[model samples]
Target: MGRRSDHSPDELRELLVLSGHALMGERGFAKFSAREAARRAGYSVGTIYNVFGGLDSYLIAINSRTFRQWGAWLEAALIDAPSDRAGRIEALVRAYFGFAQNNQNVWMAIYDHRIDRSIEIASEDDAAREGLTSIVDREVASTLGLNDNDARRLVRSLIATVHGHCALWLTGSYALLEEKDPAGQAVDRVLEILTHHLTPSES
Candidate 1:
């Protein structure tokens, strides 16, 4: 029974996060307060404070979960790719866009400033930068022939391209991938361009 009660805190926290997502998705973060989230979660405002320091912490928790989910999806996509490097890049790009479409609110929360600023949430910019560096260091630089600095630069470029394309797609600025199936084609085009730029010439 103790363990059952012990699990309640975590379960309640998850409920709060889910409620936060919905509220934030509907009204934007600034309009959504702790009381609102607590009400949505069917809990007391004090309960919310018990779980999270404030709305900022709650939003951070939600965004962190989103990042972890996206990262895991990308990692699996990379692992499931064909042996070729280009194939891996293509898989990564496809997975990213798929995640964007499937998790639009979360994607927007991470990308769009207006939405993010509402919650007073700090950008995940540094975390993303560090993550990009790790991917380049472990996967690209070490596995390939590139030095650390070059690998970091290349990874930065790739991240920029992905974010740019994803931002356009998420904001409906580009109608090219508005539909479900068009995402693969869009990713393929981006992968082709990246491959052409990154693949070394035959001696």
Candidate 2:
């Protein structure tokens, strides 16, 4: 017979994930440990393994949850944003910067951790990852009136541009700029440049 656990498997997994998330939020990916998570959860190390298989799996779970939570936050922030194409796009970009700043450790961890290829993806996990992409796609499609293919391409470019600006801002690349919010100014400048390329029909 299998060893009995005080908490059900599902409950134990959630507890482990929650604890792991707290640890990562404090120390980020570099310092997070399954042992610490187990301690936080008041479960034995063996129990964490039983719940999540290993630390990598637990980390992946945390990353997955992070994506879902981030997506929801972005969605809520966009709700009250202006419906005009340019306004909405700018809002989305600003929201991205805020999210990155507020959750620097957790947000970065999404890209910091590398998952094994052999690990099977759950449907919800895939959906969580796609949620952010879909938001951008929807906005791009509506704003540019482009087909799905073109909108996807544009979304990818827009995301790259936003990420580049944010990354540069994080590295203090815009420190000397005259603008009060260098990152915001960078975002506006990049958007202006990209918008300039749009022909009448494309917009």
Candidate 3:
């Protein structure tokens, strides 16, 4: 960043998000600092507070960006996924594991950062964060031939199943369980859940 004055307001906001996102990637939530983010974006700490209102708001923006990036990564991973529904779900599960393994710091920060209760999440940022779930909800609806409400309900349950497996893998708890191929297990669990709703021919 040559001069903070060189960037317009929108540019500055983008820079702030990018800087904070990068910082979270490198140092994770515990070590994250708005001061460092401002320094990286070539601005004073006061400038960040003035622009964003507070650290919680700033963190939400950064984490929302992370969610978008994660969604992109998942989409890219599915590019060569098999044509069959089960295969595509398998690809999604594997990609979920792959992202967490590859981007440990930033991935964990998505869960680790907690906003102050008083700070309401901005609508745009909340929507960005929800995008990941939307993808899965759509897929679930298509897979089960269900309506939007049913799909949303089922997606939440299946996501919890997959997320648990991913969390176990991340925390090295898989070793304790003597498990192999946790991603495969996640795929299996997802399919099992769908099977409960499927007719024999559909299954």
Candidate 4:
């Protein structure tokens, strides 16, 4: 036989998402195309429609997958954090860097304004944001005893810091720093700053 060919519709959809992510990472959203995504995913144009309804829907599905992966990684990392406040904050910071390193492309896509423009065409963007908000609310805020507003603010700050750090790292601005474990030290310092802000006494 040529191959086993065991892929189901769900499996094929997942593959399409993976392929779309790869293309977006390599050439970005403006340059990515449905035909290219289908080719890379080992599917036909018709199959892409069957799985996602259309090109815009397919891109939304891909973006949703990226958010889902991010949420899962965050949840797993938080679950293993120490119960103490400081320890939990440190774990969260480390988890941020860990996710950046492991999913640099997807992370870039998540924050890239170029890709954000695609949100106008699909409803999945809102779903992805909701999923992310849930993680931030439960794992980051609830663990630290903050109210919903504080949690959202703190999480936004943390995300902003990580995004700046990751963007610089990706653009080679941290080449010298990278020579000495830049990401680790950067994450530690971020955790220190955030923890100080989140301290009960500071409230």
lDDT of 2 by residue, 82-193 (tens): 9876777778888888887898888878877888898876777788888888888776655664566876777787787778777666545654334357557756875785
lDDT of 4: 0.69
lDDT by residue for model 3 (63-162), tens: 8887888888888888988988888899988998898888888888878887768879999998987899888876667667677677778888888898
- RMSD in Å for all candidates: 5.2, 3.3, 2.1, 4.7
Candidate 2, residue 5: the lDDT equals: 59
| Full-model lDDT for every candidate | 0.65, 0.76, 0.84, 0.69
- Point to the candidate with the largest TM-score: 3
- Angstrom error at residue 8, model 1: 6.1
What's the lDDT for candidate 1?
A: 0.65
Per-candidate TM-score against the hidden true structure: 0.69, 0.84, 0.90, 0.69
CA shift of 3, model 2, Å: 9.5
For model 4, state the Cα shift of residue 90 in Å.
1.8
Q: Judged by lDDT against the true structure, how good is candidate 2?
A: 0.76
Candidate 1, superposed: residue stretches over 4 Å from native: 1-12, 22-33, 113-139, 174-203
Superposed on all Cα atoms, model 4 deviates from the true structure by an RMSD in Å of: 4.7
Best candidate according to lDDT: 3
Rank all candidate structures by their lDDT, best first, as comma-separated numbers: 3, 2, 4, 1
